[model samples]
Every structure is written in C-alpha cells, then in structure tokens.
Target chain A: MNEVSKPIPVADAETAPYWDGCREGRLLIQQCADCRRRRFPPHRLCPHCHSANADWVEATGRGKVYSWIVVNHPVPKEVYREEVPYVVALIELEEGVRMVSNIVGCDPHDVAADMPVSVFFEPADGGMVLPRFRPATGAA
Target chain B: MYGLRDKYAIAGVGETAYTRNSGVPVLDLAVEACLNAARDAGVDVKDVDGIVSYNFGDSAPAIAVATALGIPNVGYAVDFAGGGNAANLITLSAAAAMEAGLAKKVLCFRAMNGRSGFRLGGGREMLARGVTQHTAPFGWITYPQAMAMWARRHIVKYGTSAEEFGSVAVTFRENASLNERAMQRAPITMDDYLASRFIVEPFRMLDICLESDGACAVLMTDAARAKDMAKKPVYIMGGAYGGGPDQGEDLFDAIRWPDHSENYAAYIADDLWKSAGVGPRDVDVAQIYDCFTYSVLMQLEGFGFAKPGEAGAYCASGAIRRDGELPLNTHGGLLSEAYIHGFNHVVEAVRQLRGECGPRQVEGAEIALTTAGAMTCGSAMVLRN
Candidate 1:
C-alpha cells in the first residue's frame, strides 16, 4: 500500500478499521452486531441500538446517486485548487448507507439522482487511492 | 396561560453589534448576548444555574461565561449543532434539563460575530469547517448561492416572481423597524428589492442573510417555578431535533423539488407536531427560520402551513404579513431583527405570546411555532400560554 495521504479528521478509535479498509481497496461500513443493522460514515457506536458492539462489513460499493450538484467554482486550495467543474454527489450504497464522494469518469451533466453507480478508487497525486464513484448498471 | 405568566419572563436580552470584520472577539459577543438575554428575562447573573447554547462561537464548557461574570456553578451544559440550530437545541435542552431535575434556572444562548470574529470567507479557512468545504468549493459557495440553484428550479417549476420574493424583504424590514436590536431598520420596498443587485443569479443581495456579530438567549424553569417567576410562562408544548442521514439513489443529485432543508426543518416540524399531538392549527403565530426569505417560504410548506409550490401564493396573499391570518417574523426575524442564527426567532415567539411587543407584537398570540435549519440538521419547538 502507498503512503497514507490526508489524515482522517473526525474518524477516531472505533472508526479506524473502516478507514483501514479504504487503503486496502475495500469499502467497509459498520454493521451492528446485535441489531443486524448497517451504518455508514463510521461511528463509535451503533446509532440504531446505541450498542458499542459492531463489526466492519465490506460493501459492494454499488448504489444510486441520491442527490448531487455540479461544482463549477474553484476548489478550496487546501483540498485542491483545480478549477475543473466536477460532480460532487452523495452515493447511497446498495447496503443502505449514503456517503459523499466525487463522481469521476463522466461528464458533470451525465449525473442524475437515482442513477445507478459503483465505487472505484484512483491514485492521487499523493500516495492514497482516493475513493470515488462511477456510473454503473445492475449486473453480476 | 394566565396565572404567573408575567412573573419570571424575559426581562432583558443583549447582543454585540454584528459586522463583517468587527475587531471585537467572538467570546465578547456571546457574553453580550447572554447578558442581554438575562436582562430581557430580568434575571440576575447568579440566578442562572443552567447553561445551554447551540455551539457556534463559544467553546464547550460554557461555564467560562459564568466564571467571568462572577456567577459560579453553571449546573447545565450543552453544545450541539452549528448555524442557527442551537435555537431549539438550547431551549429543548434547557427545558428538559429543568424538567428532568438537572437545573432549575437555565440560560439558552447562541452568539457569533461570524464575519468579524473569523471572517467566514469561502477559501482554505472554510475547508477546515465541518461541511463548508463539501459543497462550497464546487461552486456552491455562500449559503444563499447554494440555495439559489434550488430557488431557480422552484421559479421555473412554479412560475414564482422576483416581486414575490421582494415582498418578503419588505415585510421583514417593516417589522424590524420596531426591533431596536436589528441592524437594518430602514424601510425597503418591492421596487427596491427587485432592483437590488443579484448575488447568485436569481437571488439578489437582499435574499442573503446578513453576516453579523450578535447573540440571543432564553431562560427556562419548569412550569411550576415559572409560575412564581417574573414573566409569562411561555410553556413548551413540544419540541424535536432530527433529520435524514439517508443517501439513497440520487442522494448526490441536487434536489428537483429542492427541499434544501430536507434533512432538518421539515422533520423538525413534523416530529414536533407529532410529539405535541398538535398540528399547525394549534399555532397562533410562527417564527420560522428566515436565513433567507425562501427559507421562510420553504418552511411554510414544510411545517404544513401551505403546500409545496403554494408558498409563493400563500406569502403573496399577505398570510405571513404581520397582520395576516398567521403572523410571521414579528420581531423582524433574521431578515431584519438580527441574525442571531435562529435563537432570536425563539425569543420573539416568547415575546409575542406574552403580548410583550408594544407596536410590532401580534395581538393575542397564544400558541407559537418556531423552527430552524442547521447545515442539514433542523429543530423546532411549540410554545403555548
């Protein structure tokens, strides 16, 4: 694995493992051990049952674009100053969790709400393979 | 609603002046707001046992204010949400903290000299903020600019007008003239609103919320003790703070109907109404969030006052006018009163219910509903006599 790029801001202790999966080219979400409920954007405890007992579950990374906006403005310099208008979208994983990720490999206009898409990671200028998303169709 | 209603009321409310780069510190604004709210409530500093605030400007452990003011032992503590969200959060927390045997007398506050204290500019500094970096860099820069995209879609879908939008500004300015705390009390006409320069295409400069240094507070004790207190006991009938975390298909897509407050305001109203077992019918007045006039229009639909696409007409009918069937923004609201986030809305609701407003007050207001929108979180509360 390449060197880790940006440090996780809000993620801590219990959320570490989920971030770890991203480095390994895997999308891991949280699943409550007791309630059989799945959670996204990793947290320390299960929000459904407030149970601390949970496990990291690998996700299929395929879902629909719930809502999105085409960003034409210059990006924040700290993140990236590229002036490219990219589609920033919230992807709802098939496993029933929504995570915000940049939609890559398509024109900004091509993206739409509820459009099927799948997760794909790419190498960044830095060492990390940034987790992004691409349009997809239902298939095996 | 009558007995002890005028006893332990809001005797005083204070705030630091808001400016783009007001050199004054943010903490100073919070202290000012706290002091003003106490004055509005007519309570002494030492009498405040509970400390509650929506976390925006102040740090956690707000006892610092208590310590600074020589009032020791802030028995209650809270820091939740950002933006004007703290309005309901502080109130609900203070009310419950008092009800659940946490603290007897509580102070609920939100203060931020956002523009001056930190200069809420849209660049690198914004990236460090919670979700400011998320949509901001991608062309959705300012809060109103982000909402403007949806506003355009609404105009297209429903055929709303610039004139209609201006009416909201006019009404707010009219009411705010009576609010000594408001930054802009000058009269504005639809001609002026329509003529104002545009900030985000369809949205003009007036469409955006002011960036100011201001604070607001509310004091609470259980209904039992409130009866013996100084002012009218504006009873908390119901309250809720919640929103959707769902990211379904199209989660990333900008809204078609464009309920910008999909997560917070709508649900806050629904849940609060459900919990109180009362609908909008029970409300005599509404202190809806007015970060933008569109927000008020959107909330009117969200809170069940009007149907979607009908807010333009509802507002145009002067329904939300100060003398309409259901008065709104009686204290001028954020649009004119002061952008104390949404905290000022709650304070005004209490004022109207108590019939405390001299000229701007809504006559004989009994039940009032106040709502707010956090980034995506929202909260609302119902107050009754």
Candidate 2:
C-alpha cells in the first residue's frame, strides 16, 4: 500500500459498519426504510423519512456527471506534488449522492456536465481503495 | 435576515492586516484579533464562554485563544460548515445560543489567508484529492471560474456586458479606498476597471478580491447582557439563511429549472427572504458579499434589490456607494478589504448601527441587511439599534 498519514474518518458505532463494508470494496448507501430515498456520506437517519429501519446494499455505481471542476494548477505543498494539474469533480453518484472525486483517463478540459460516468476503484494510501470516475461506454 | 433586532449587540470588532505575502500564521493572527476583541469589548478574555465560527475553521485559532484568554469550560462551541456564509452563519448560531441561554456572550469570526495559505486558485490539491469530482473540467475549476460560467448564461439572457460586470469592481474599490481596513483601497474608474489586467478573461484583476493573510472577529451577546458590556447592543430584528441551487443532473438542468429566479440569483435569496419574513425593500444598509464583482451583481439581483441586469446600472448610479441610499461594504469588502470570507461585512454592519464609522457611517442607521454570495448557503441578519 502507498504510504500515507491516512484519514481516520469519524468512525464510531454509527459508522463502523459502513467502513467495514467499504473494506470489502462494495459501495453502500443509507436509505430511509420508510421513504426509500438514498443518501450519501452515511448519516444516522433518513433525510426524508427519518426512519431508523435500514440495511446496507451494494450500489450499481453508475451516475451522470452532475457538476465538475478541472484543476490544472500548482500543487499545494502539503499534498502529493506528482498529482499536479489533475481534474477534480463533484460526481453525483447514481445512488443520489454527490461526492467529491477526481475524473481519470481524460484531460481536464474534456470533462463535461451531464457526461455519463461509472465508478472505478483505485488503490489509495493506507491499504484502502478510493472511488474514482471514468467515462461510461457509449455515454452522452 | 437572521432575526437580529436589538435582541443582541455586537460589542467589539477587530482585524489583522490583509496581505497574501505576509509570513504570519493564519491561526495566530486570528487569535490575536480575537483577544483584541476581548479588550475592545472592555472585558477580559476570561469572559469568553461562547465561540462560534465557520466549519472551515482551524482548531488552532480557537484552541489557542481559549488557552491564552484563560476561558474555561466554554459553554458554547461550534463551526458552521458553509463557505462564504461563515460570518453570517456564526451570527445566527451565536444569537441562537444566546436566546437559548446556553451562553451569555458569543463571538463569531472567520480567519484565513486562503489566498496566501491555501492557494485555492491552483485547484491542484482539491483535484488530486478528487474533491468536486464531477463539476466541469475545462471550466468551473475555481470560485471565479464556476461563477464566470454562471455569469455567461446570464449575459446571454440579460444582455449584460463585461463592462457592466466591471461596474461591480469599480464600486467595490470606490468604497474600499475610503476604508482603512481594505487592502486594495485605491481610487478606480470604470475605464480602469475594464482596462485593468485580466486574471480570467472578462474578469479583470480589479474584479477579483485580494488574497490576504488575516483574521477578523465580532462579539455578539444577548441584548440585555450587552448593557453591562463596553458597547451598546444592536437588536437582532430578523435572521435568515438559504441554500444554493441543488446540484442538478446537468448544467442545462440548472439553467432550465432555475428555482431561484434571476431576480434573486439563486435559492439562498429565496431562503433568506423567507426566513426574514420580509422582502428586498425592507433593507436599509446592505453588505452583500463581494468575493468577485459578479457575486455582488448576482446577489443584488438575487436579493431583489434590482432586476437581473439592472444591478449593473444600479451600482453605476452610485446607489450602493458608501454615502448612497443603500450604503454598502463600508469596510470595503473582500474585493477591496481583507478576504476573510465575508466576516468583515458583519463587523461593518455593526459599526453602522452603532454610528461609530465617522465618514463612512450611515447616519441614523437602524437596519443592516447582509447576504452571502452564490452557491449560497449563508445567514442574513437585520440589525437595528
């Protein structure tokens, strides 16, 4: 695994199970047992229904390019300098969750809003897999 | 408007120098001014039990400040997570805490040299971490970039020109020059605004705010508790907060289904108005955020002060000047003043209500309306003496 100081997400009893699932390389989202609406970053309750009844399920990992920004500038000294001028975006995951992520396999300028994309997990620091995006096959 | 009427008073205000090249640490500067606020309010640091700031806050500022001021068992502490809305959000939270009796005094602040320290314009770090993973590649890389694209669409609809956009920069400088706290305090002409070097095409260097390493803070407390403090209390008549347009499926999705009419820029204006239980005409003094010139323009229209494109003309008419009917950003603004997000705007509003600002003071100032900028998630307060 690549060396890193590793971000220990605030994983307590409420979040432990979620991280355990991520360790298995499966994307899980919280949905209101009552409303059946999906939400991201794993919360305690449903934003819509406020129901507590819920379970974990694998996401299809298919989403469209909702909004994005192409970062092509100098690197912050604190971060990996080798990753300079990369394209970072805000992907609206198919699960109705918006996450900050980077779009790989393309130039920064090529990123377009509404572009079809899918998740492609990449090896990250601290023996974990990070979610990234790639252009979907035959996507608009 | 976040319900500020004489319900609470801003007892003190302080700031550090605004400069990007300064080698000072951001947290130290922030703490320095916070302690200064303690003195300005005619109280010792030990009196501080409530501290509310932006979620973007660094722990160093508050933690070190607590230790330095000998404030023990802080009854209230929070960091509201929203960009640009830091000051206003803090105000709302402070007022709430005061109303709840959780604390007798609350201090709100924003401190950073995002320009000097973070180098957000570089965007490389945010990109590497893959934050904002799906925005736009060729465009919308930074705040100005994202706003520029939004502005492009408005120009097409409103027939507003780049020069019209330039008017925001001109107004900011005109007001900032008179403000000693402002960084880019220089006399600016419309021609100079247009002709100045372009940082982003159509967005001139003059149009953007300065990058500075500084911190600013304001102290607010219950209206009753304020009487014993050094400064008179400014009531919190109203307070409101609004969100920005939801992340649409596509850029066209945003443009096609703009829930926030051009009159209010985006949804935050709608949220603020609803919270205040009033509309645009209720505002007496205005302190609209000015991260860039267009931010002010969009906010003016978004807040329903004018029509979509009418902001350009309204600003040009000197209505937003320091001495104008709707005096604005009398401490300059992020553009001319230090860019500690929108923190200073709140302080300036309090000064207006207290009648402390001599030449820039708006006489008989009773109410102040402040708004955070686009992608809006800020709190607005109507303050009256």
Candidate 3:
C-alpha cells in the first residue's frame, strides 16, 4: 500500500500523557483513583465512578478487534488517496478500554471482528509517533 | 403529563423537489419551502411571527427566512443543536410557543445542499469539540464510520447478516419507487444491495442516505384553529426528545452499559408510547429515520416494534413494506428520498395521514409515527388524523 499522508494528532492537556507514552513505546491509559477502573481518551473525571482523581498506567498493548471497517472512500488529506482502501478498527484492549486506530500489517479486507492485535508506534506527520494496531502474529 | 399533546396540529407541509444538486444557495431553498408552507397553511407571509431551525448552522437562519419572505418581525425564535433531534424539537418548540401564547403561526424548516454544496461525506471538521478531538486523528471522522462500528458490533452479537440489512434498503427503495419526489426511485433487490460498494465495511453504499440539495418545511398552530385550514391538520398526539447516558462517549467503550442495545430510542420509548396513549399496534405507518439502513433496524427494536436481536428477522419478514402491517418510510425516506435531514420524514408522515400519497398511501392510515435518526440524541412524533 502507498503511504497516505496521515493527520497528526496534537496532544492536549488531557491526552498528552497518552501520546507521550506512545512515543516511548508504552501504551498508557488513565486509571481512576477511586474505582480503580481504566479509561481511554483521558478525561478529567472517571466515566465509571465520576471521580476526578485518576492516574496513568501502562497497558499490555494487546487487544482484540471488537469491530472494524474497510474505508473505501478518500481520507481527510489529499495524500491519503493512494491508500484508498484502509482498515479502521475499534480495538478492545485486555484492560477493557476500546480505542479507535488503523489496523496495519494485513490486507484491508482480511481483517475481521475478534482478530488479535497489538499496539505499535509509527512516525507520523508533525514528528509525532502515533500508536496503530497490527496483527499480534507480527505478519508485517 | 405531556401538556402540549394534541393541543397543536400541523397546519401545512411543503417540500422543494428532492435533487442531488439545486445549484442555488441553501437560503433560496429555505425561502421556497417556508413560503410554500405559508401558502399551504392559507396564512399570509407577513403574518408568520415565529421561526425555528435546527442548530446545524448549515441552513438559512430563521430570521433570514423571515426577512426573505418579508415578515415584519420575529417572535420566539430558536436554533438548537443536534441535527435529527431538531426534527421533533423544532415542531415541539412551535407547539410550546402556541401553548404559551407566544406566537400564533410558527414555521419550522430544514434546508441543505448536502451533496452539491456542503457535503457531510468529507472528513473535514463538522463538530469541533468532544468526540472529534479523539476520533478525527485516527481517520474516524464521518458519521458512516461511527455508525458502522455500531452496526458491526450489532452484527457480531446478533449474527445479523448483510442480507438482513439489505432488506431495509430494498424496502425503502420499493417505497421510494412509488414516490416521484424521491431522489432515487429505482427499485433495488437484495442482490443489488449485496452487490453495492462499501463506503465503510458492514455499511454498503446502499445503506447510507443520499446527500441531496433540497429543503422541507412545516407550519404549526393550535389544533382548534387548524380545523378550518386548507388541509387536514395532523394532530400531534404525543412527542418526546432526549438521550441516554454518555451519549457523546465512544460507543465501543460502553458496550457494557446496562443493556448494550438501549439507545435514545429505547430509553425514550416509555414516554413516547405512554403519552401518545397508543402502542406499536396502533401505529398505521412509521417514518423512522433512515440515515443508514442499520439505524432503521436498530430503531425498529428500539421503539419496541420487535425484540432485541429479532428486528433483522422482522424486517426480512416484509413487515415494513408498503402492503405490510407496519408500513414504513412510504416516501422512501432519506435513504432513497432526498435527505432534507429528517424533516422530509416529518413531511411524509403528514402526507400519509392526509391520504395525499395516492399510489404509496397506506390504506386507512389514521396515525403516523415520525422519528429522527439516532445521532447522540433523538426525537419522535406521534401524529393522528
């Protein structure tokens, strides 16, 4: 597949730590101090317990494809046309938080629900290392 | 407990020709629909004092419509957020205004050049806050992608196949084929639906709504005054609009929420049915939002038409077809008909109850249920002749 110009994510106060972990090859998520539940897309308050107190924890980075889509349409940037058909997957991590990411290292059509995956960091636009998922078997 | 129930009636309904490209500004479409509705209601354009449009910010503002139509002044104008939610909320807003004696005649409309002008297909920012901050970076930008995830999960859990989803497309196409105003009137078979291209996996091209350039408008007033109007006033039996918990949160993250299938439609079911003093059996026709085919399937179960995991089979059984027990989307809906957001559904619901739909009219249709799509929020209206 041709390299598509991917949109780089700018880290914000709530999500910066997660991006920082991706840069360092650590899959980090927020853990609620009150209920001890983990969450993705870091927020100020815990969605489960509604507690404001939370801390970061490194994840195992292993997950299963809860659901997926093969996007046949063009992506945001014009450069993404070269990669017309790409895999956009929702991965349910072992820690029980589901996050959206691309499934690399496999044919776009070959990916299916419940496929095993692992998080990997790749250099993206803006000198940022983005975390994407790949087949757990290291197919690429 | 719904005080506005049966107090207000739809005085008039008007729609511009549904097309893919109008080549005119959305403002023009707004004026045409609003003026047509005013003319249909037998009310002078200068007499309309209240105006309301959904807060999409893509269409002509209420004041803009009023100014274009030469209205003297505006009273009780509102433009609230949420696209499909505005379908019922705007009408309900008009009803509330009439109840409060704020305005006599109220105009509610939705106008968009969705295909030729401003397209919802692109990944460009639509809503800037909340979900976009997380989903956009991953190319999870459009509604199809988000809704596809929901469909995919539903399929995995219920063994719902693509054929079942295609049935909805076929059913709507059949309905739209009889509707001359619908954008796509060609009948589609299940094979055609299965053969269609996939914009997003689990959601074929046929499953998504057409992005058309058109608009639809409705006029509302007190039920007692509507008795002498140009057309039969479709009384609003009961209506409700609300959302479930964490509606804006990531869908996949909350797979464990009480009942995974309980969307806003499911959550608001009790209020909708109870206030209307009717059940699923009493609904002669239903215009459930068809932004995507799976949504129709979900809403079928959400509104208590079928048990969870049984809607797919219920659809396959041809219950939603024209001659079926519960005729749905008789005007083809957004899937085949023009996507005037969800306002087109409202117009179709009114027309069916009025017996104006000659070929596709549901026999003895006395009550119609019009619903908006499930878009982080939803709204529903139960109307009776």
Candidate 4:
C-alpha cells in the first residue's frame, strides 16, 4: 500500500485523546460514567444514558469482524490503486462498540464474519497513527 | 389526519436527455427542465410562485433557476440540504406550501452535472472532511465500500446470496433496455452481473448506480387547478421522511446505527402506509432507490413488501420485473437510468401514474411508491392517479 499518499486523520478536542492513545500504542474509548457503556468516536454526551459525564478508558483492543468488504475500487485517491483488494472491516469491539478499520496481516479473502481480531497501531502521513486490526492469535 | 391526501397533484414532469455529459451549464439544464415542465403542464412560467430543490452542493439553486426561467415574484423558495434523502421531501415541502396558501404553482427540480462537473464519486480532498477523516486513513472512503459493509452484514445475517442481489441488477437492466432515455439500456443477465468486476466485495460494478449529467423537474399545484392542466395529474396521496434513532450520524457511522440491516424505511413505513390509506400490496408499481442493489432488498422488507430477510427471495422470484407483482424502477432506476440523484425516480413514478412511460409502463398502474436514499435518514412518497 502507498502509505505516503494515504490521508491522515485530523483530531478535534473530543477525538484528540483517542488519537493520543493510538500514538502511545493503546486503544482508548469513551465510557459513560453514569451508564457504564462504551462508545467510539469520542463524544461529550453518552447516547445511551444522555449523560455528559464520561471517561476515556483503555480498551482490550480485541474484537470480531462483524462485517467487511474487500475494496477493489481506488477511491478518494489514486494512491489507493496499489492498495486495491485491501480489507476494510467493521470491528465489533469487546467493549460493545463497533469501529471502521482495516484487517491487515491477512489475505483479504481470509477475513470472515465473526473472525476474532485484535488492534495494532500504524504510523501514517504526518505524525498521526491509525488503529488497525488483524486476526487474533490463539483465539476462536 | 391524511389532510394532504389527493389535495395537491403533480401536473407535469420533465427532464433533459439523460447523458454522460450535458455540455451545458448546470443552470441551463435546470432551466430547460423547468421550462419543459411548464410546457408539459401548459402553464405559464410566470405563474410558478414557489420553487424547491435539493442537492449536496452540486446543483443550481431554486431561486437562481427561478430567475433564469423568468418566474416573476417567487413567494416561497427553498434549497434543501443533502442529496437523494431530500428528493421526496422537497416535493412534499412544495405541497405543504400550496396547502398553506403560500404559492399557487410550485416547481421542484434537481439539476446537476454529476458526471461532467462535481461527481458524487469521492475524492482525496473529500476524504479529509467530516466523518470521512476517521475512515479515510484506513482506506474506507467511498459509498460503495460503506454500503458494501452493510450488504455483507445482511448477507451473513440472512444468508442472502450474491445471486439474489444480482437478480435486482438483471431485472433493472431488462427494464432499462426498454427505456431509450436510460444510460445503460443493454440487456444484462445474471451472469453479466456476477461476472462484473467488484467495486467493493459484495457490490459489483453493476450493483452500483450510474453517474450521469442530467436534470429532472416536476410541477405541483392544487388538485383543483391540476384538473385543467395538459397532462393527467398524479395526486400526492401521502408520504414520510426523516429517520429513527441515531439517523443523524453519517452513513458510514454504523457504530451508532443500531441495525445495519434495517434502513430509514422501516422507521417510516407505518406512517407512509397509514397516511396513504394503502398497504404495500395495494401499490401497483414502485421506484425504490437503487444506490445499490442490496438497498432495494432492504427497502422491500422495510416497506412491508417482503418479510424481514426474505427480500432476496422476493427479488429472485421475479416480483420486481415489469409484469411482476410490484414492478420496480420502470425507468430502469439509478442503477440503469441516469442518476439524477433519485429525482428521476420521482419523475418515473409520476410518468408511470400518467401512463406516459411508453413500452416500460406498468399495466393498469394507478398507485406508485418512490423512495430516496437507502441508509441513514431518507424519504418516501406515495402517489396515484
């Protein structure tokens, strides 16, 4: 994949911590202080309990492939042309929130629904890091 | 309750020739379509007091189109935000304006050089904006990829085979073959669909909608006034728009959307049927949005035409074919017809009701349903002659 031309994510105040966690090789997600529920794409208010109180808690960084697609069409950039046939998946995290990421370290055809996976941070353009997933080790 | 039922009517519908490149400014396409609608309705352009349109920052604004068409003294005008999701709502808003005595004749249009100018196809710069910023870094940056994820989930959950999804493409292609205005009018078989290259896994090239440069317009007025129009009036029976919980989130944000299998149709189906005083079975034809083939399956189930998870089997049964129980996308839909971003679907519905679709016209068609947008917040309308 052409990592040099790949777009890097810009973080706002609400999402800065999550990116910060990625840079430090940790996965962070917002946990509602009142409902004790976890949410991705950090926000101030809890959607479940409508609570403004929340905390950035470390995640297990493990999940199952809920669904995925092998992208053959290079979109948003011609740089992705070489990256065609990459697996972009929705990972249902252990904490009960789902996220968009790539399933690396495996053949695109090998990824399947309910396949257990774990997260790893990868450096990107600029000083940003991205959380991507791969097949879990020693797990069903 | 149901006060708008048959109160306003679509007196005329018009369109520029569906093409890959119009070779004209977006305003010219808009004016041509608006004037054609006025000619079709036999109404003077100056009489159109209200103008409404919707776009994703791609089309000529309603006021600009009004000025170009020389429609004097526009009393009410609105340019709705978003894309196909606002297709039905824009027409409904015009009807609302008519009902409130804000305007006499309203013109609703969608004009864009979707192919030649600002394409809906995502670009590198677009990836840096809004929610896409989060997904772009991972190479998740296009509508087909996002929708394919949902299609994958539906297939896994329901065992909906890829062949069943191809059935929609084949059937719509057959319909398009009869439509001279369709961009993809060649007949395609299920084999053609399956053999097509995958834009995203679970979504082949045939499964995605065409991007064409075109425009469509519809004229709306009170039923009493429509009685004197040139063409048969297709009454606005009823409709619904908006979404359920977490619908405000971006289409790719499946994190907050509780059910990937269900779309906004499920949430608004009850209101749509109740207000129309008709069930799904009562409709003779439908123009379900076909941003992707799987979306047609999801809507078939959500709108009560098929049971949950059975829409695949329903399509495979040839129910959406021209002579089938519920003929769909008689003008070939966005999949085959020019994608005017679902506004053309509304045009097809109006034409079907008026018996103007020539060879592809549904037999004995009186009622038709048209839906816009597949995921996130969307809209649907029920119309009849």
Give the TM-scores of the predictions, in the order they appear. Answer: 0.71, 0.71, 0.93, 0.97
Model 2, B36-103: lDDT tens digits are 67777887767888887773443244555666557886888776665675567678878778878788
The worst-scoring run of ten residues by lDDT in candidate 3 chain B lies at B251-260
Name the candidate, 3 or 4, with the larger DockQ value. Answer: 4
* Tens digit of per-residue lDDT, candidate 2, span A1-106: 2333323233455555654665776667677677787765555776567777776767777777654544333223244345545555556777766665567787
lDDT of 4 by residue, B1-385 (tens): 1578999999988899989889999999999999999889999989999999998788888999999988888989999987778899999899889878899999999999989999886654533545666777888777787788879879888999989999999999899999999999999988888899988898999999999999999999999999999998999899898777866356555556778888888988998999888989899999999989999999999999999899999999998999999999988999999899899999999889988889998988999999997887788999999
Off by over 4 Å in 2: A1-140, B1-5, B55-61, B126-131, B136-140, B244-279
Error of 4 at A39 (Å): 1.7
Compose the digit string of candidate 3's lDDT tens values, residues B25-114.
999999999889978888887888898988455788888888899898677677776577568888877888878888888999999988
Q: Grade the docking of candidate 3.
A: acceptable
Write the residue-wise lDDT of candidate 1 on B117-217 in tens digits. 54332432332123332233233444554555555545655677777777778888888888776778898988888888765446677876666666666
The number of clashing residue pairs in each candidate reads: 46, 38, 0, 1
TM-score of chain B of each: 0.86, 0.88, 0.95, 0.97
Runs off by more than 4 Å, candidate 3: A1-5, A47-51, A137-140, B126-130, B249-262
After superposition, the stretches of candidate 4 with alpha carbons farther than 4 Å from their true spots are: A1-4, B124-129
Candidate order (DockQ)? 4, 3, 1, 2
Candidate 1 chain A minimal-lDDT segment of 10 residues: A1-10
Model 1 residue-pair collision total: 46
| lDDT of all predictions | 0.66, 0.65, 0.82, 0.88
